[model samples]
Target: MAPASPAGSAPASPRLPAPSRGRRPGMARLEVDRAFPRSPRGVLKIARTLVALAALICFLASDAHEAYTALAGMETVITGLFLLLYLLRLDARMRCLFWPLADIFNSVVAALFLLVVGLFAIIIKTNKGTLAGGVLGLILLVLCLVDVVLLCKKISLDKARGRSAPAK
Candidate 1:
């Protein structure tokens, strides 16, 4: 017979409870939604993205070549930022990606860029194509303005709460 084991000893071949469903034993898993449907800023960011995308689509379908050219760069920047934020949101879990100051800065820049592009495109020309692009561009600019306002409010609230700004 084997020597008596110490009191309260576990089995010689210790076994872990069967891993849940598909995960391997000892793997750490963090639960996160496929998309950030719960975050307000995430929704707002997505709305801004849709507005920018609409402007781009209008430019493509419109006859206004000049307006499209002028607005292209600004739209690209907004779209890129949107994609980055959205991709990061997939893994955000419960962690706050809070960067009120940075968001404010981005919102301001996007608003200014959209405003300038919209005005420049309108002053330069107007056709059926330009009309479509211009109208969409205006909408995009409004969304940017909303983003700026929301971000500014968040920044002020954060400051009042004594939270330092995010690192550059």
Candidate 2:
């Protein structure tokens, strides 16, 4: 007669295969986590972004004659802030995309603003006109608006999906 195996010790019935690694076992892979402004830093970023947007709107809504004179000296400051935020945001987003064309566009815009600011400062010192600076400021303002719109869309999508964004 064959020998009887001990209870609970029959070699575990030829153990089942281990589950595959590196993939979610049974659940859908969660994409974005929390929406924008979810953290303190993100809140601050959103506030600054809104402020920049408001400034742009104010610059555009007022009568050109009145706003132009009032906003002339602020061109450099606003553009600089916008460029800084744009670069920070682009850096944060770079890892999300394989190609990251947004990063490239942001870098190009920031470089252009830097050049404008530098040239504007030099020209002001030499009593030259401020037309070029004004134009650059307008361009940067438009770019900031575009960024804001894109961010809003992303945040809305993340919210709809009910996932927290992965921290950068």
Candidate 3:
């Protein structure tokens, strides 16, 4: 058996600290739910990714430039990862693997692309396919913005609580 700790000692785990005078006696610690980020942000990301994929499909083989191709591939991967994160419930566990800033960065980039590409496609040429894809991209932009806002809120709350965005 392990030896008993001294009368005054700290626990072994670094994730949490011993109760302090600042906290109420016998009160349970408040924690962010494991599924917190998965709810609105994950759901919105999935929807936006699907819209992006559909837009890409409509214009596939039409764009000879490599920029659109790279962007399409990125969108596909983003879609897959978003779905995976939701299904696996990895948001709370991802803090060790990556920083929350990555999430914010990705959302900002996706939103910018959706706005720019969508507007450019719509304005450059007036056609059924372009119009459809452009409108879808704009819809995706709105969703991405929503995700970004939610992520920022989560990040701020985590910081205020002295916890990582993915506390687990």
Candidate 4:
């Protein structure tokens, strides 16, 4: 048998401070804009995302051409990115770019393309899914136009008020 250790002869173990109760280890605290989702732009963006997703689904179900499916998918991603940019308040942090103008441009371009794709989808009349997708695309186009109008009005209002439009 090994010899017994003497009292107080054991090695000391270091003690560490306890972690804070409010946060978990290695997890970042997220700063969410609580009011963003309730704002008009946010609502429109949410609607756009849903509509784009529906259109994409319809095209996929109907075996439409890849171009149609790709357009819907691209719109979904772009809108989602914009939504996240606002929702997370990243736009405020990144002040170099004018977000409103970019948003308006995106809306206009998307509307134009959606118009052509929607019309083509309807004209082809390959199946019910294509028809449904076309209708949704048209609806999305309307929403995009509305978004552009709202943004433009907001910018003009800010200019009239003698103050620069806020980035957020």
Candidate 5:
């Protein structure tokens, strides 16, 4: 049996602790698109990252010129960023940025830089690492070009499909 409050007074309610904004250990769930890494585009991005890292390592190990080292390092970081964006499905979440066009621009610019720096590295090679890094850079250049081509083709197809649909 419970006692009622006197004089028509309301009962007091218990208060709850406010939730913490930060993620807790073992409690935070990262919604990664697991299927992404297995897709062709994801595979290509992964290959680009791996090659960029290899080139960076070669440059660092051989004490190649600063320009070669910088280019390799920058490319590795940028490619990894793109990979993370896709893996985490950020492209879908963040609607402001047009990811496909950005990706194409990145690919084209990277290809140009790699071509120039890679030739220089090869021509002025003072050690084996420089030569290897240059070759890898050339490989990276090809990969970037491939990425650009794929992205362009995909974009064109998407636009074509969109145009074929009846307007609302």
Candidate 6:
């Protein structure tokens, strides 16, 4: 038997029990249900990544010009709606990964795009009166749709995961 610790001194170290099967000894057991990137920062990072991808597609695609015009026209309306939804989401305390300020800025950018689209459409209509801008607009609209769908899917998955996790 080990000698007892002296009075007023640190207690003797107790022998730790063996870890259960498949676990290593001395390793901590983490709560497996914990969510990944479990903070607003993580969410924001994900949102930024998605936004970057969209931007890249818009900038690099050779055939995007035709679609871009129509998309510009719709940008303001869609962005306003997005901003409103985001505000509501924040009010509800939803776990958004990105920074609120950044999100707001992004929404503003979307609105600006819409404004630009409108201007371009008007100029083209008045000067050329042709469907020259249709292609870019369509492409942009499609990209927006894809973005929305992906975002919804991600949110759904996150919510489902959150629900399935055991309470801390």
- Model 5 lDDT tens row, 1-168: 667777877776688777767877566456799998998888999999999999999999999989999999999999999999989888777767878899999999999999999999899988999999999999999999999988888889978889435367
- Pairs that clash in candidate 3: none
Better of 1 and 3 by TM-score: 3
* Weakest lDDT window of 10 consecutive positions for candidate 6: 126-135
The lDDT for every candidate, in the order shown, is 0.64, 0.46, 0.69, 0.91, 0.91, 0.46
lDDT of 2 by residue, 44-73 (tens): 445434543443443344423333333433
Candidate 6 — which residues are off by over 4 angstroms?
A: 1-75, 84-130, 163-168
Per-model TM against the reference: 0.60, 0.28, 0.64, 0.79, 0.80, 0.29
Per model, how many backbone clashes are there? 1, 6, 0, 0, 0, 17
Task: List the RMSD of every prediction in angstroms.
Answer: 6.8, 15.9, 12.9, 6.2, 6.2, 13.2
TM-score of 6: 0.29
Report the CA-based lDDT of candidate 5 relative to the real structure: 0.91
lDDT of 1 by residue, 1-168 (tens): 877778998647767787489887776665444565456666777776676766676677665565465465456565566546555543234236554555667777767766776776677655665556666677777876777786687667878987655455
Best candidate (score: TM-score): 5
Off by over 4 Å in 2: 1-129, 164-168
Ranking by TM-score: 5, 4, 3, 1, 6, 2
lDDT per residue as tens, model 6, 60-132 = 3424455453453345344444444453344234444443334445545554564466345545553332223
Q: Flag clash pairs in model 5.
A: none
Q: What's the CA error at residue 93 for candidate 5, in Å?
A: 1.2
Q: Model 4, range 1-168, lDDT digits (tens) per residue?
A: 666667878655588798678887876666899998898988999999999999999999999988889999999999999999989888777789878899999999999999999999999979999999999999999999999998999889878997685545
